[model samples]
Target: MDDFDALSAMAERCFPGLETWNRDQIESQLKVFPEGQICIEIDGKLAASSSSLIMEYDAGLEWHNWKAISDSGYIRNHKPKGDTLYGIEMMVDPEFRGMKLSRRMYDARKDLCRRKNLSQIIIGGRIPGYHKHADKMSAREYIDSVLEKHNYDPVLTAQLSNGFIVRGLTPNYLPADGESCGYATYSAWTNLEYVAGAKRRFHHVIEPIRICVVQYQLRTIRKFEEFHQQCEFFMDTASDYKCDFVLFPELFTTQLLSLPSVDASRPGQAARQLAAFTPQYLDIFTEMAVKYNINVIGGSQFVVENDTLYNVAYLFRRDGSIGKQYKIHITPSERKWWGVSPGKKVEVFDTDCGPIAIQICYDIEFPELTRIATQKGAQIVFVPFNTDTRHGYLRVRYCAQARCIENHLYVAISGCTGNLPFVENSDIHYAQSGIFTPADAEFARDAIADECNPNVETLIIHDLDFEQLRRHRDQGSVQNWNDRKTDMYRVVYQEDEKTFEV
Candidate 1:
C-alpha cells in the first residue's frame, strides 16, 4: 500500500472526484514530508491513513481551509521545529470504517505528537454528512450539535470524542464536497502530557548549569588514604559552590607513582604500575559523585586493557553510574616514550546538566573529533590536559578556544599546575584552568566564563545559563553551528569501534 499506485487508488476510492489525490501528488507529498504520510495496514492491505506536518500554531488559529494550511494536502508549509502538528488528511477504507480503524489512526497521530514534543494538534475536520442538514442549520449549528452529542457526524463526531474542541467553522473548505454547501470546522487538541517549560523554549532546553575546572597540583602519594583525602577536598570545595559538574586534569593518577613499590624515575613503568590502583581511583570518584550529588569527570588515566595500554577518562554520575571515554588521539611522546596505544573512539557522556564529551590532552588538537562529539548532541567538551611547559599549555588552551568557537558549544579545560618532582613524566607541569564560551555578544567580553591563575592550584567555577546559549544560537552575529556548508561538504568518520566503548 506504500506504493504510489496503491496509495492513489485508496484515496480515489475513499474520496471520489476532486477530493482524491493523484499518484503524482502522493509521490510528491512523500518526497517532501515523508514523516507526515502514515498508513495502517491490516492483512497486508491499507486499512486507514493519516498525514501530518509540524507547523506554527498561529497558522491554525483561524477558519482556514485545508488547502490554505497544507498545499492541497501536500503540506508545503511544514516546519521541522514547529510547536504544532497539523493534520493534513485522515481516510479509512470504507470496508474497515466500522472497525474503529480511524480511532487507531488518530491515536497513532497523537503518539507522534507526543514523541515530537509538540504542544498541540490541529485539523480541519470535513463535514462529509452535512449536506442533508444544510437547510435546517448552518455549519456552526451542525458542529455545536456534534459537540453536545445531540447529533453525531461521521468525521466531526469522532473528532469531538477524541478530545478536540471546535475553534470555528470555515466556509467553502472543500468546494467538491456538497456537504453543508462546502464547509469545515477548525479544531485543536492540546497535548495533556506536554512538558511544561523548557520544551517550549524555542525548541531548545533552558537549564541552569554550573561547572568547576580544577588546576590541581601534582603530589607524591605515600598511601591511598592521602589520595582519597585530596579528592574529597576538591569535591567538597566545588560542591559547596553548587557546581553541577566538576572536571579534573589528565593523568592526575600519575601521583600514584609515589607508592614505594612503583618506580617514580621511569614514567612509563610508573604509569603501568599505577594500573593496579585504577579500581580504587574509579571507586573514589564514584563515591564522590554520589556524595556531592554532581557529575564528575575524574580526568584521564593510563590503563592496560587486552594487553594494550591506553589513556582513558572516567565519568561518574550522581546516581553511581560510571561511563568511560578513551583518548582517541595520542601524542608523539606518548607513543615513543610511553609506548601508549591510542584510543579508537569519541564518546558523549549524558548528565543532568546536558550531554558532554571529554577529549584528553592532545585529542583536543583534532577539531574533527570534538566536532563529531558535538554533532552527537554534546553541548560541552571537557579537556583534561597535562602539559610540561608553557608552550605545551598554550597549545591546549588555544586549541580549546578554537574548538569552542568552531563547535559553538561550551569548552572546559582543566590541567595539572604543579609538578611531582619525584616522578619522571609528572615533573615540570604548567596550566591555567578555564571554562570558555563561544566568542559572541551574548557571552563575556573575553569569551572566558571563568579562569584560574596560571601555574596555580585552584578551582574555577561559573554558572552557565542554558537559555542564553539557546538564544545566542539563533541571534548570534556569527552562527557557526548553523552556518556550515553542509550541502557542499560533510564531516564523515571512519570505522573505529573501540573509540566509542563505555
Candidate 2:
C-alpha cells in the first residue's frame, strides 16, 4: 500500500500531461496481485515500477488496446490460472534511466516468469518516436528503419534491447499519447526455461489423492466443545492416514440443536438458532484444517445471509483459505420446515491435488449441476448428505453413481448415521457412505471404490488415482465426457445473473 503514492508520482513524471494509473487503479493492482506489481528502490527512493498480470494468451485473437487489455489499468481481469505473464506498464524515473534500472526491472520480470513457469512475457510497448516520422513514412516503414538503425524509438528500442521480439503493431493503444501517435508495438519474450508438457498455473502432475469420508453419528451433544472435539478427532484421524481431504455429512453441526436452548418443534426458529453457530463452526474447522495439514470439507451448515437462510458447504483449505458452495437445490422438507433458500451458483474449488466440487445431498440428483462442475474441470465430486430414510439415502447413492458414470469422474459421498432424536425432522437417519468410480477396465469391479457398512458411525479411507482417471476419460471403454453432443443439447448454468451454456 505504501508503494501507491510513489508509483502514482512516478507515472506522472514518466508520462506528464497524459493519462496514467490513478490511485484507485494502483490499489486494485496491489490488492489483486501484489506479486505481479514490482518496484525498485535505490537507497529508500522509488526509482522504477512495473505492473503485470497472468492471462490465457491466444495468438489468433484480435489485439485489444491498453485500456481493454489491462482492464483500464485496474488489472481486475488477471487470471491466476493463466499460463502467460502480460506486462501492462513499466516506468523508470527520468533521473534513473541511464542507471540501467529498466534492464534490472526486465530481469526481475524474467525471473518471475521462469519461477511461475509461465510460457512467455508479452507487452504492448509504446512507439514514442512515431509522431516525428508519421508524415514521412508508414508505421511499418518506421519500424523497419528503426530495426536498420536509421531511426530510434525510446520505448520500443529499450524493449528490443532487453531480449523482446516484435510480433506486430497495435493501433490506438493509448489514444492520449500523442508522442507515439497512438501506436504501440506488440512484443514478447519467451521463457526458455519453461518445460514442455508441464501442468500450467496452480496445477501439478496427477497423483493419487487419499480421501477420508466420515459417516458422522448424529448423537446428542451437550455443547459446541463436544462437536469441536469430534470434528478434530476425524481431522486427526484423516491426517494420520495422510489423506488430502476429509468429507463430513451435511448439517452434522445440527447436533447443536440437541442443546436445551434450541427448539426443534419450531423448525424455522431452530434453523436460525443453528445458523448462529456459523462463526464458531468456521473457526474450529479452519483451525483443524491448518493444524492437521489437511483440507476439510466441513460439511454443510445453515447460514443466514441478506436475511435469507441457505445451506452452505465450506472448503477449509489447509492454507487457511476458505471456499464455499451453497446447496443450489432445496428439497421440499428443507423449504417447508426450515425455510432454506436455494443457492444460485455451482462452483469448482481448486486444490493442490486438483479441482473438486461439493454437491450437497439433493444437489447430486440434479445432473446439470455436476455436469457444469465437471465441465469446469472438476475431477472429484464430494456429496455430503443427511437423509433420514432408506429411500432418501438410495436416491442419493444411485444418483451419485450415475453422475460418476455419465461424467467420467469420481464421486465420494458420506452422510449422518445414528439419530438426532431431539431434532424434529432430522430425528431418524440412514446412510451407507461410499466412494464410486466409473465402470471400466481400469477401475474396481462393480465401479465401487469402497463402501462402509450401512447406518454405521465410521469413516472410509480410500485413494483416488487421478492419472488413471485421466487416462480412463480419454481411452476408456466409453468416453462420456468427450461424447457429449453439445451441438444438440447442453447444460447451462447461471453465473452473476448471466446464463452460460456449458
Candidate 3:
C-alpha cells in the first residue's frame, strides 16, 4: 500500500501539471467510468491509469456537450461528419517511467478508437511553461513514435512537433498555480479503408437492375415495297422526316413468320422474301443515319445465315457503319417462326449514345440475360416484340420493367402494333414501353394508364443519365433485394425449372 502511494506521488512528479487527485476522487471517477478507465495495480497499489469515452460525441464531460452542437449535422447525418475526438487521460508512475507505461496507455486508447468506430484521438498536449521544465524527453514524442509504429497518421500538431498539426488552442489560465499556456489539441484519425481492403472486400449484387426505356417514333412503315412505285414517295418522306433510323416491327412488312402459308416444303421461299426487305431497309437506314447523325434499330427479323435462320436486329450508326447487329436472344417461341438456332452468347455493343443491347420479345422475360447485360455495363437495352397472343403480353412488359429496376438500365421495346387474325378471336396485345428508374419504376408503370382505352402504341423517349444510375447504386435502398444472403441458404430448383448448367 505504501509502495502504491509512493508510485502515485512519483507519477505526479513526472507529469507535473497532472491533477494530484486524492485516492477518494480517483476511486469515484473509476467507479463511474468502469469501462472507460484502465488501472494497473502494483503491490496492491494503483500505479498507472488511463480513461476515455468511445462515442461519436463527448459523452464523458458536460463541457464537451458544446461540441455536439457544433457537430449537430454530422451526427444527424445531414452534413459530413468531421473527425471524432477521443479525450484520453493517461497517468504513469515515475518509478515505472523507464518501462514507458505512457506508451501502453496510448496503445490501449488507439484500440478503443478502432473498436468503437472513432477515427481520431485528441490529446490535451503539454503546453510549454514560462520556465524550462526538468523533464528531458517529451511525452508527446513518445506518443507520436508509438502511434507511428501502429500506422496512425499524424494530422494534428500540438505544442511544437513538425509532423503534428494543431486542431484547437485553449487560453492559458491554469487553476493549478494559476499557470496556463494555451492547451494545444492534436488528433490522429483512424484509417479503416486500408484495413478493410486488406481483408478482401467483395460486393454481392444478386438481382440485376431492370431498365425500361424507349426510342422515338419511326415513319417508314407505309413504303414496304408492296407498291414498288411508292419507293420514291417512301424515300422522300423518310428524308423529309430526317429519319436517322426507323424501327419497323419484325416480319410486319412481309408478314413472314405469322403467315398461315409457311410450310416445310418451301421454307427457302420465306427466307427469300425476308432477305428482299433487309437490303432495301438497310441501305435507307444506313444512308439516313449518316446524313442526319442518328441511330436506327432494324427490329428483330429472320436472317438467313448459312441456310440456318437466326432472329437478328441491326443497329445502324450514323457513321455509315453498323454497331451491334446482334442476333436476338431466342426462345422456344421463336423456333416456330423461323426455326432459328438460339443466339448462343449475350452481346452488348458500344455506340455514341451508350452501350446498346438487343433482346427479342421472349428474351426480355429472363432476368439473368438482362443481368448479364447490366454486369457488362449496358446502358440501353432494345426490346423488339412479335406476339402470338395477349396471353403473355402483360408478363413481357412486367419483366421488362423488372429488368430496368434490377439492372438500372434503360429499355426501349417496339411492339408489333398491327392485328393478326388467328383462330376465332382477333387477339392483339400491345406492350406499353417506357424507361424506368429505381425512383421512377412504379411511377413509369403507373403512367401507362389502361391501353384498352384505345391509346396509340406508346413510344417513350428520354435521355437516361449515367450519373443518376451510379448514385442509385451507391446510396439507394436495396428494397430488400440486396439483403438476400445467397451464401447461406441453397435452394435447389425442381427439374422443370432448373436454371444452373451441369
Candidate 4:
C-alpha cells in the first residue's frame, strides 16, 4: 500500500477522462488478495499494474456487471475459497505501451493462479474499438468480427491472443466508459495445469523442439525393400541429430510407380497400385519412429479407403502410436486425372512436445485449415507438398508462410526435389523445403528458420522455441490471433465441431 499514490497516478494516466481507482479501493484490493495485485517497476517508477480477486465463477449462474462483481472497485465480495481468479482491473501507463509490461503482469497472474491452485482466470475485457463501429454494426456483430480477426480491439484482442476464450458479453459492464459503449467481453483462460486439491508446484519449462525437413529426391526404384532402405537412411540421420520430428515430402512414395511391374500409362491404375503399398508404408515409418525414438511425418500418399482414393499424411509417434489427416482440398489435376477425393476433417495430433497439424500439397493453399488447427491448440504445422513446377511449389510456399504469420505458429514445409522418369504425372518435381516462423523480432529475421536449397536432395534441421512463441502471442508487435473479429465471420469444421471466428 506504500505505493498507492504512484498507482493512482498511473491509473489516471491509463484511463484518462474516466474515473480512476481511489486510495481506498486500492487498499481494499491489496488487503483482500495481495498476491493477486501486481505492479511492475521500470527505472524506479510504476509502469503497469493488475488487480484481481478469487471467486466462484459460473457464467450460467451469474449475470454480473463490473461494479457489482468488483464491489464498486472495493472487492469486498472477494471469496477466499473460490476456484476462479477474477481480474477487476489492468492498467499500463501510456508512455510504456510496447514494452510488453502487460504480458509480464499476465504471466504473474498465471503464476499466482497456479500457486493458489485456482482452476482458471476470468476477466471482463473492454472492447474500446466497438464505439467506433457502433453505427455500422451491433455489439454482438462487432465482437464476433473481432473474434474472427476481421476487426481489432486494443484491449480484448491482446487478452484473447494471450490464451483467453470468450464466454459471453456483459452489457452495461462499465456505464462510465464511453469507449466500449458500456459493454465488455467476458473471457476466460483455463489453467490446464490446475490440479484439484494439489499444492503449489514450479512451472514446467518448455524446451525447444527440433525439426528435420527432408527435400526428398524421387528416383526409379526396383523393389519395396529399396524404398524402405532409403527411408531408413533419412530416419537415421534425423535421429542422429536428436531431432524431435522429421518430415518427408508428399508423394515420395509415388516412386514405387516407377517399378517395372506397374502400368505407368494408366494414371488411375498406377495410383491404385501405389495404394497397395499403404500397409507397407505405415509399417516402415512406424518401425522407424520407434527404432530411432523420433516422431515422423511420413509425408503423403494415395490411399484407397472404402473404394475412394484420398491423399493422406501420417504422424508416427515415438511411442508407436500413429495419427493421420487426409488432404482436405483436391487440385484440378488431382480430380481430373488422379481421381482423388477431398478429405472431410481437419485434425491436430498430440506429441510429447505439443500438438501439431499436417497439410498436404494443395491443402496448404487454404488458410482456413491452419486457422482451425491453431484454434484447437496446435503449436506447429507440418506441410508435405509435391509440385511439378516452380509456380506450383511457390503456391504452397507462400501459403504456408501466410499461415505462419496469420496464426502465429511455426510451419515446416518439405517437398519432392527430383524426377520420376517412368511415372506419368509425377515425371518432374521442384521444391525448396523451408521451416517458416512468424514475422516478429523474437523469431528469425526473414521468418525462415532453415531451408534446403531449391531442387536439392538434402535436409534442413532447426530447433523451434515454443516458449518464445507463447511469449510472442501474448506480447508481439501485432497479435494476429487475438485481434480477430469473430462476430463478423467464422470458419467451421463440421467434423469436430471446431470453429474459428473473426
Each prediction's TM-score versus the true structure: 0.59, 0.61, 0.45, 0.60
Q: Write the per-residue lDDT of candidate 4 for residues 400-419, one digit (tens) a residue.
A: 99998999999999999788
Cα lDDT tens digits, model 2, 143-235, are 888888898888888788789999898888888888888888899999877775566533435578999999999888878889998888888
In candidate 1, what are the lDDT values of residues 1-502, reduced to their tens digit? 2555666677777777655676666776787778778887765787778888888667434437677677766666778777788888898878766555676577678878876778899888888778778889877887777778878789998888678888878887887776546788888999766764434433334466889888898877778888789878999888767678999999888877777778767667776887778888988898788666678999988889997888999999876799998888888888776778877777888887778999999999988888789878898898999999989999999999998888788889999876677776677789988999989988999999989999988988888887787777778888787788888767777655323310
The model with the greater lDDT, 2 or 3, is: 2
Ranking by lDDT: 2, 4, 1, 3
Candidates ranked, most accurate by TM-score first? 2, 4, 1, 3
Question: Which pairs of residues have clashing backbones in candidate 1?
Answer: 131-180, 344-499, 345-499
Residue 265 displacement (Å), model 4: 1.2
Q: For candidate 2, what is the TM-score?
A: 0.61
Candidate with the greatest lDDT versus the true structure: 2
Q: Which is the winner by lDDT between candidate 3 and candidate 4?
A: 4
Give Cα-based local distance difference scores for all models: 0.81, 0.88, 0.48, 0.87
**Candidate 2 clash total?**
0
For model 4, state the Cα shift of residue 66 in Å.
Answer: 66
**RMSD of each candidate relative to the true structure:** 17.1, 17.5, 24.5, 22.1
CA lDDT, candidate 1, residue 370:
82
* Most TM-score-accurate candidate: 2
